[model samples]
Target: MFTLPFSALALSLCASAASALNSKRHASLAQRIKSEQPALRSPVWHGLGRDTNFQITDNCTGSTFFDCFDYFTDADPTHGDVVFVNESDAWSLGLVSTTPTQSFLRVDNSTSLPSGQGRNSVRLGTKKTYDGALFVLDVEHMPFGCATWPAFWTVSQTQPWPLGGEIDIVEGVNLNPLNQMTLHTGPGCAPNTSASDYTGQQLGTTCPSSDGANAGCGFLDRSNTSYGAGLNAAGGGVFAMHWDGGGVSIWHWTHDEQPCDLADLSGSPDPSGWGTPAAAWVANGCSPYTYLTDHQAIIETTLCGDWANSNYAAAGCPGTCSDAVMDPSNFNDAYWQINYFSVFVES
Candidate 1:
């Protein structure tokens, strides 16, 4: 989850602490598993389960745009220096707009605020919640810039924090060239041997959000064109996330590279024909029902939050995150031009 409301450095330190404790407590089990499985496996995605036919349940596009989501006006959970305005303010400030072909959610790139004031932005979340379903995000452009943290994610709607779970499908900070997919949940959930059976590079195998270390299981998509400036230049395409009893799979494709099935979203979606996904977290043993449920999808752009602030210097961006926010031009490209957000369920 991108917005766990904790500092990234703190999370890393907490994870290290948890790891140390786990190492002492589960040494034997860890050793056994290490011996049983190879440290590295093939990068190819193995079809663990066949895809099911899907029918569109809710499609947010065109005239029904504003009706599909609610503008979140609360303070940012990630502590970003952003002010999330309500629907009226969003429209009045030009932070949100919609057309028959596209909908826009953007940071206030034209107004330079006071030195300490947060930038005006919009965070929109779906009104409907989902348990196990297929989510398709068709975008034309995504937010990106120094100190900008943009994410398209889902968190449990009914449970408290990590108890339910959070899934970050499209997330990245600063000028990162690749997309990150992560899961933040409680204990008793970890990846199996087949966890590496995806195109993306696996960052972690554990999926717990305890000890203040929301460093859940994560994968990094290898494609440079999967996010940031490259994604905008290539003309954004489809990002599909399949979540069910079997597991979770994420796929990303540039507009020119998208599969034929996605070309016409009106037809039923079959993941089996979509080829290997960009990332996959197979259940093998991890129970989706127990760890993840009743999630509401979200799209937001924040500034100098937990992740972005911690990695500010490392990303080689100029000045402080605060400094970047004061410059209106810094966020000119920090916007999401979305074509549609559609949820599909098994037929």
Candidate 2:
């Protein structure tokens, strides 16, 4: 989710087949937050050679996963009904844990809290920041339920947001069956849609983080199993974000379809062999080097923020967004089981 200053954009711009479907499923909130903003694969180089190889720089995995990330204990910038807990609290509350095989991130699903008190959850960002790289995430399960919002993304930690840019690799609210890929950048930057090639369907053309209340350009994945319940049912998958001089692209592969090169963190990854990406932002209009840089990978699950609150009824979920948070049983499946996250850069 983007955490930039909000300015209202046309509700029509937010219109999409998915939203239309949501409209049919759930009723809209009284007032919507318009700022909700919401990739890929091949190694074939535009200016660089096809021989370009990406080597793993940071392989965050296993029991040490906790040490690789910093707990974000601050207030939810999206104003979700969540209290971002510190590492200590996160451990005690069972919000985060690491094992030899994977890491687990979960929100408090047992405690029925009073009104206005956000539930306990964990938000984490990698300690290392990168200007440009290939990010590969191996996921086994992700949070899902009414009023739940989960995302895996990258945003700059060194510069003010939109200045450094934001790239959402996997994001969705409620029981969204597909993933939404998006890019957020400052003014003067818009994706070259004509030149960009991808498999996912584009929702909006411009990438301005402000013009559309930070709606930023968004694209919805075509795979039914790319997100939420469908993703979990398919036994999870791999999400890759490739950001470099050419531009940024994202790809999603189900558990069985993941490329062999990506299976081994020790080997170099070749995107050229990965096929068409789900979403791509060509450098013709937006330069990745200029707009997207020095970013840390982020992972978290928030409840009933601007996007979820407004789209609550559309998902066919009962009650207001805040009310949904009070029911502990509503979040029985609210959790993330991650295999590993590997950052690769051109060698």
Candidate 3:
């Protein structure tokens, strides 16, 4: 695994800390909106198509979490210090549950194990595969504690990895306040971030795994409320990714900043009116239709993975990721509170 120098990592951490302070200010604004506009609050959309232009394929809620996702109990492919548990084990350990409208997915928060690999957790993948579509996620809380690496991403099931492409919509490690969206693909695939109207800072232009650091093509959202603690403070938010024949675009709207159409969910989402995306990847050298296909949605929280381990000390955590992750007290806040997940296809 490749790593950045301590000096660079320190700079990144400082920047994230500044973002956290700003997010606190936005959280207060969101709270005022909630108090003043009670009528704007609406439950997550759980039914099918509301308009003729889009068809809903998956309407995942707290009640449907287990039914819609397949338990991925296998070993961590990213070499994280985690043991993924089966469906029965997860529920028996109180690591997964559902209330009326929200779903809770959590890590093992009761046991203090030895400082070897780490404690057990849950990883879930959607059973349905998609070619091209719009994915919208309404989340109330996300895993944000130290040593936690939470991600909401989509990957193709092709062998050798990155052949079909991987789109990371929401991903961050350690105590990162800002979200990092990335694209990993086989050779010859690169994104023209400069040509697109995205608000994030593009770390790299090429997405080929052959890049020495395997950094891929990454864009870092500067908003502190885009991930982790800042996100939860803002009452969570909506993440929408539209992938089609042309390219892929991702947009984020905090609870107080959601568009009227998204807030109401009365009809199909209109991305044309959503303005500039946080990150937009236009296929400059590769064909998006041919390179990105047969992908399934995945939501997981792993501990001490490659990225998290690389920046553990820089993030000012207590100790090494493996050691801290085994302590049950450290992960008290490590959990996913999802309101709903919906996929819309063009009609």
Candidate 4:
């Protein structure tokens, strides 16, 4: 568990105070998780129930592009969880795409349990709305190798880019050697003040890679741990982000970390400084945050190209190849061994 500086801690509580509605949303979110979904786990995954409450069935409902819109549209499907995972259809939605073949989102985890392509991302808009809840991301496997980029993030269902803040709960780049948590804000914001806080873990630092509006974006590689440089191997850990109504906080706890706080969901963000769009930023199909405080719903697993494919294979093809992606034999596919995806509420 990572500890937040006194300043961050204070700001977190403030954020929670503002978005009290989120508390109720959390309740509704938990109820949505019905027992089973025939379309969820597919046979190719060869999954075995790791826990009682959770079951990885071998049944994927394809991409949410065609079906996902149904959730909020006219032709709603008859299903259980109303899954919106990225799949073949997702590649066409401009929401999910893989290079070379556009089949980027993997179909396999540790137990040979396949993933459902792009994470289950929902659009947050004026018509479709919610209060507050935990966005549970099923710990699916990630492309394990040197030059592989994967991400599990959220977009504002309303605005285009920075108009809504971009909360990157999970993201790793080509051989980044670390998981970088970033926020892409547009204009109407300070320059140097774009990126603030500890991008890295204990005894670590956040090194901003780009300039311009995306300056706030950076990676958190915890090499100082006794585990050595990095190891996103067979068993991947939980990469979480606590979005306090005000400010936002992120952490990477692979069953490790010193001052880590998984219980704190209170994040405080500058409403006025949520970020506008800057011409210098690259946010194509990349949606930003819009009053991201009011939480609701539980989002699950998915593999996305825009955020995951560090090699940008969807664009054309990445030069670097990994055993996991290019040749599975050469590389070991890191399984985000998922036990139970649950959201706790304040009794």
Residue-level lDDT of model 2, residues 1-347, one tens digit each, is 11111112212322343476466555444323332211243332476544787776777776877888999988888889998899999998888888887889998989998898898888999999999999988888899999899999999887887788999999999977889999998778876655347889998876877532877898999999899999999888889999988888899987667665665444567787677788888887888888887899999999999888888898898878898898888888999998888788998
Residue 177 miss distance in model 1 (angstroms)? 0.6
The best candidate by TM-score is 2
Q: In angstroms, give how far residue 140 of model 2 lies from its true place.
A: 0.6
lDDT of each: 0.81, 0.81, 0.78, 0.33
Q: Write the per-residue lDDT of candidate 3 for residues 85-202, one digit (tens) a residue.
A: 9999999999999986789999898898886856789999998988889998888889988889999999897545778888999999888989999888887886544633587888
Once fitted onto the true fold, the runs of candidate 2 whose alpha carbons sit more than 4 angstroms away are 1-44, 48-50
lDDT of 4: 0.33
Deviation from native of the Cα of residue 31 in model 3, angstroms: 35
Measured against the true structure, the TM-scores of the candidates, in listed sequence, are 0.84, 0.86, 0.83, 0.41
TM-score of model number 1: 0.84
What's the best-to-worst order under lDDT? 2, 1, 3, 4
